[model samples]
Target: MAIVKMEKMHLLALKSEQSKLMQTLQKTGIVEVIDITGDKKEEEKQGHKEDRIRDEIAKELAELETKLNNLKLGIDFLKPYSKSPNPLIYGKPDVKKDELSKILSNETKIAESLQRVFDLDKKIAQLKSEESKILNQIDFLIPWQGLDIPLEQLGNTDRTAFVAVVIPRKSKDKLEEKAKESQLPLDIKVIGEKRDDLYALIVYHRGYNEDIQSLFKEFSVTIQDFMGLKGTPNDIIEQSKRRLSDIQKEREDIKTQAQGMNQDLFNFEVLYDYYMVEKDRKTNTLKLFDTDKSFYLQAWLPKERKSYITDTISKITDMVYVEFTEPEENDDIPVLLSNSKLVEPFEVITELYSLPDPRGIDPNPYMAPFYWLFFGMMLSDAGYGIILSLFTAVALLKFKLEGSGRKFVSMFFLCGISTIIWGAIFGGWFGDLIKIKPLWINPLDNPMSVLILSFILGIIQIFTGIILNGYKNIRAGNTADAIMDQGLWLVLLTGLLMFAIQPLAGIAKYVALFGAIGLILTQGRAQKNPIMKLASGVMSLYSVTGYLSDLLSYSRLLALGLTTGVIATVINTMAKTVGGSAIGFVVMILILLGGHVFNILINILGAYVHSSRLQYIEFFSKFYDSGGRAFDPLRIKTTYVKLEDL
Candidate 1:
């Protein structure tokens, strides 16, 4: 399987049939409408009229989108307390198209329901704020409750000023003695004594205020005032407590009312899906050309589906004209990959790098086997593999995950199986819990062997990349260039590899020498001057060092595999060290479970990152023709509901 072929399509329809035609195409969800209006000059030349009907449709769609967003916000706010039958269930409630129309027509009622929830939220916030203020005031007034005078009457008299002060408790008697000695017209009344301070009220003639302030300042005194408060401190405190109780009750009532509207969440979901479809239909029309009585549209669709699309459009209306043509060689055709189900999950990895150019080969099928093997080798734990597989299996079966989400989980599920296989081969059954011997040597016992295996696999992947590049060149009718660029290097590397082995050294030396001479003579064939060509060929031979480095990059696979086993074994050893008394055994169980789980999580992450790095940096850098645009079909993008086929 490779990139799916695409064909350009042009359609002409009467203005009256435009809406029906667009609806049909959107429902089919296979075509990608090309933006003909992107070029200002081309748009000016065409001079297409802006249809008022489309403008009105756009306005309506915008309003609908806003309404949907508001409704969703309200639904999300209430969801935690909604008490659904099964919160883990993923599918949205189904509703017919006509029922959706009916719901939309009653937009006023839905808006009112959403507004009610919003109003309650706002009121609850205000009530909470008020409650906090009241509680703080009560705490503050509790310290001043012993004063018998009303706070507002503290300075009511024109001739007298009243002030509250806190002085060190030990100095209360001294302050009284000093006040009497000063002979100021002031009344000193000690209200209360806290741990380290005495609360007092001082009433003095207005004229003696400055003198009294000076006297108090001489002995460190903090002035406390409850300004703008009416009635006695105790009365005010009681009143605030009552108000706080009322606010709490009101807040609870508002919460109950908001929770009661949770059933409307389903309605909101339906409307959200409805607006999404409507928005897509309106937005797609912007790419169309419109006249007073007709509309012209252009799009791209899969070539294999041309007949099906034609038949579907014909069924919609015979008045519309459709034409399909092959895309040109130089055209920027969108890429849509086609692969067997087994290989499809790895497309997630390829897509993250870049889509293959329409003219280039799809790399997913080529990279899948290697990626799976690398992931397994890095993780290399049978127990972790079983856990990972089960976790993903439950998620896949329990949820309706789609698109990238579904592919990602499926990829991990497959990787888990690969991990299990590698684990069994390497004798990693939960870090030697099972006494079964390894089919292959354990990395801990013989790390050099594992490292050698990593390099060997790396060499194979590199060779595969080179072979694929050569194949691509051959298909493009550049056999000479392909041989010089890929084939010569392949031969040279193979010869060198053979020469490294003791048995083939004698024959391999001559083979490598022959390949080296061929590369030196032919690598710069396109150059004009002999000296420059030969110099360039000599420089090209230096890339052998790069190839060697790429081979060494795979050593991380062995490193990670060993790291996982060593950490797991450490966890087991720690668990065993603590196993003595009953309490010690229980502690050992806790430590073993938590430590192993944490180790598994950390190792799995390391395995995924390192494995992906090898593929992306070492493998894909070879021959991937990136920068192709992804195929984005005109389709319904639902947020809450999946639309069933009509």
Candidate 2:
């Protein structure tokens, strides 16, 4: 594993040729454009405006961004209706060179189609709003269907005042008594009842209005207003039902029309990618410095891509100037990992933690083996391993996964293989559902053996990390630090282990003492005071406890490994208990299926989390130097389609 070497790039081209050159660079997809004009305003503040070029593409970029947003909205609107292929099965739609060119030239067709979709979406929105209002009206009117008078006719006449009131069913009798006491021309009619309230219409003489109004308020009356409605309750409900039916039909028609334009959705995606390419070019163009007739561009790119970029640009225009130079020590060089196909998937682990420093060693190749072993041991079930391997293998073969998605699937596929191996070694096939002889030791029968194995693996990995740290120090010309730090620790640990052997006990004591003396003398060499140096060196021995704690973390491997097998065994036992009759057999099958699936899912999560913990906390902490920025170049990035030519 290695970090790809990078070089600084300087480019000068005619202002007229800027667009063409940018297009070329984007297609190459290697150059990371540097923003040299970042301090334009600062320079202007200092009264040096002659060297500044007015941002020519800013307005165009803004317009393009707006158009892109609208286009994206249109696509999202139609996505529910379109019969798009499943991304998991088909990946992004691929457009060949001729197809792309054809779609690019037919911009008018796509624009018209997008407008039509937008119009239909707007229509649907309006229809939905109308539908909501009609539904509400229908609900309100259904409770008043017994009211015979039209809503408009319920208003006051010349002699009497008419008002619709709703009061509690228990308050109805009190209102009747109050109306009787008023001795006015007050008529109260119970029109309808809903829940705990009665809908009533009250008509009273205007001369008795104050008395009738007071009685109405004292009876807990709620006045209903249908002032904007023209028809009776029954008439309004019927009309609303008819309108709802019509709205439903109209919405269905719109959905049908939108679904019919799914082909245009694909074309819209192509045009989106085209605009994206253009937008990126314009964005990077702002990073350049321009004069009256020429522009200057600076970038960083992989050193190996130098010849390819130079040749490609030279073919386009011979007048352009290009230069490449070694990156300076202080330059913020971006990190790109390069590894073998087998080791590549493990890069996702390092990436999730952080990319390794450009000047340090790549840890993927070293950390991957331990991660694989740990994951397999944690999920040691042959049947589940087979399923994982087959599923991931099929996905890798049938689906076009890219970037982290591809790496993740690939990693699980390899981990599945490791699981199979460990499963066989531990004699764990579906947790003893199938009778098989032990290839090695059954962890359930002899857990201590497996615990010892986990500890040994942890010790080996720890030593590997320390050696890698030593390598990094040696590479950086810090041999003294490597010997005093990594070398002495290894010696001490090795001697401690040797103490377990009877024959080496005598030598082990001296070996351990020598390592301790060396660390005590050198670990505090940076301190100035002699007394402080001795105290610091004495304190350094406490780190052995930290190392012991890290080593203990590996026991999770045995713990989780046992957890998977034990749970599988419990499921099998439960399933067996239910199996006697034909129906019982069916129940047993269901239990086995559901239980094993759940067990696999839960343990897989545990394995992944714990496995990564070992790497990040135990392994990487020893040697990994993070904080390098990832490489992000100006290139054609698309969401819905892949450009075959590019």
Candidate 3:
């Protein structure tokens, strides 16, 4: 049965009667103009005002963001000098009043010290980069390929940071012994009393594996704990003493501000709030229609489609008691404007989420079938289908995403499964060996079957449309005429398909010939249009070519499936041939990896596009209405503050 998507008029009126229409609209979260374009503006005296708290907080957050940006700039300016080559000492945060004052009064010294420390880091990083370049070159050889070893087992995990340690200061003798055994050269430095330890910092001259902890453990480096003293910078002390005074003043200002809100500042904010608000403000009204009741009925239609009112609303029902009049003129305002021909999908999704209670059911309940069918047909490759469905399944299970991305992903998963079934029926196992005998003939070898199937599907969906039209007619209280006009068309199309005009033979043709007669007599029965009526009836026959062409398009789905499988097969074949030569083994492996990856990427894209095309043309045309506004409530929104909180 075709679905009717209409609400009972009287019930809809009841919903709008109690609350302010403007408030309900504002709550929708759509960007809207504040001007009272219509007479539905809020009543200022009663005070059911929109929440300003969130907006105010949002404004304050924006200002804070600007200030934070400036603060970052100031901090960045002092960074270069603070990162000089000398290391800086870390002191405990000052707790005593005098000690805290002293540190605050020496911002120049602090900034300078910090810069020198950064400089030291840069120097060390540069040295390490050079050392690693040489190591990488040496490791390019096969013998060093699996030589990653750990240093932690040698007991060195707790040190601040150590590059490399040569063992035994006099390891000259020990190193000589090791060199003799391994045929490897070593350079060791003597250190400590009596030069008993022949250890030198190897500068980790090789790159520090960025994954140092793993490297330490892997290299089996022993950490006998740290032994070095904290390094001091003797050269920077004089410079720090000379630059203290000017920075001290700036530091004190920063300190005072960080100490939190004072009474005067808090009072100033309250005063500012008072200065901005008015104790008495006038009200605004948005009156859509104000007049004595009569035969007229006002519709809150898609404001853009107001021009099509007479045609759409008039045909939907048979209530002579109600009539629609033109909306009263108003100044131009920016808002969605559309005539009845078409509405975008975004708007359709939106409408589904909102809309009040209705007598006629929403069309959404019926579109699911056409949607699923088209989705499956477009994505009809078992291989891509399996991947798409499984990927979406994992995402859905692991995380809850929302809005367009979520809906799109969900659609892909659904269509993918459908594609899998279609692929199976077509005997398309990623273009595996073509089957000679299958439950359904493959699209490649048997194009005629797919064409016929496509036609059958079109007929089925069109029949569904006809049935729904009949239901809409009957629901309007013209049960007999609904059957005559709508039911007659269904029988007419069925006769054309089944009887084929040949079976009807002579006298039997008389029954099939009644379609136009029925339309001429009954179509627009309220208005006289005999010739035009018959013409409208003939329009149904115009579908011969549309049906032919659209059905042919379905074969593309088969073509795409074939492409995905054929390409993968070709890649494998070429790669295997290349691998046959002794010297070509590695090259063949690379070719195999590169070819399959490329094929998978391209096929995935093709599957997505083909699948999407089916939904848009075949399924959506079947009754997939897509112009509803989505319902969204207010949400807690934050950007930087929460991210920076820690």
RMSD, one per candidate, in order: 3.4, 2.8, 21.0
Q: Using Cα atoms with residue i matched to residue i, what is each candidate's TM-score against the true structure?
A: 0.90, 0.93, 0.44
lDDT agreement with native, every candidate: 0.84, 0.89, 0.44
Q: What lDDT does candidate 1 reach at residue 403?
A: 76
Q: Candidate 2 on 1-646: residue-level lDDT in tens? A: 5899999999999988988899889988899998988756754432334334343477788888987997898889888998989777888878999999998888888899999988998998899899999999888888889988889888778987889889899998888886777676778888888889998888888888888778878888889988589879999999999999999999999989988998888888877777887888889988888876788898999999999999999999988999999988888889999999989998998899899888888899899899999999999998889988999999999998899999999999999999999998998888889888778999999999999999999999999999999999988999989999999999988888788789999899999998999999988999999999999999999999989999999999999999999999999999999999999999999999999999999998999999999999999999989998999999988888888775
lDDT of 3 by residue, 6-75 (tens): 2111111221331233233222323222233244445522222222432443465555454334334333
Q: Name the best candidate (by TM-score).
A: 2
Candidate 2 C-alpha error for residue 323, in Å: 2.4
Pick by lDDT: 2 or 3, better one: 2
Best by lDDT: 2
- What tens-digit string does per-residue lDDT give for candidate 1 at 113-187? 788778877887788788888888987787688998888877637888888888888777787788889888877
Model 3, CA-based lDDT: 0.44
Candidate 2 is scored at a TM of: 0.93
Clashes of 2: 0
Candidate 1 vs. true structure, TM-score: 0.90
Clashes in predicted model 1: 0
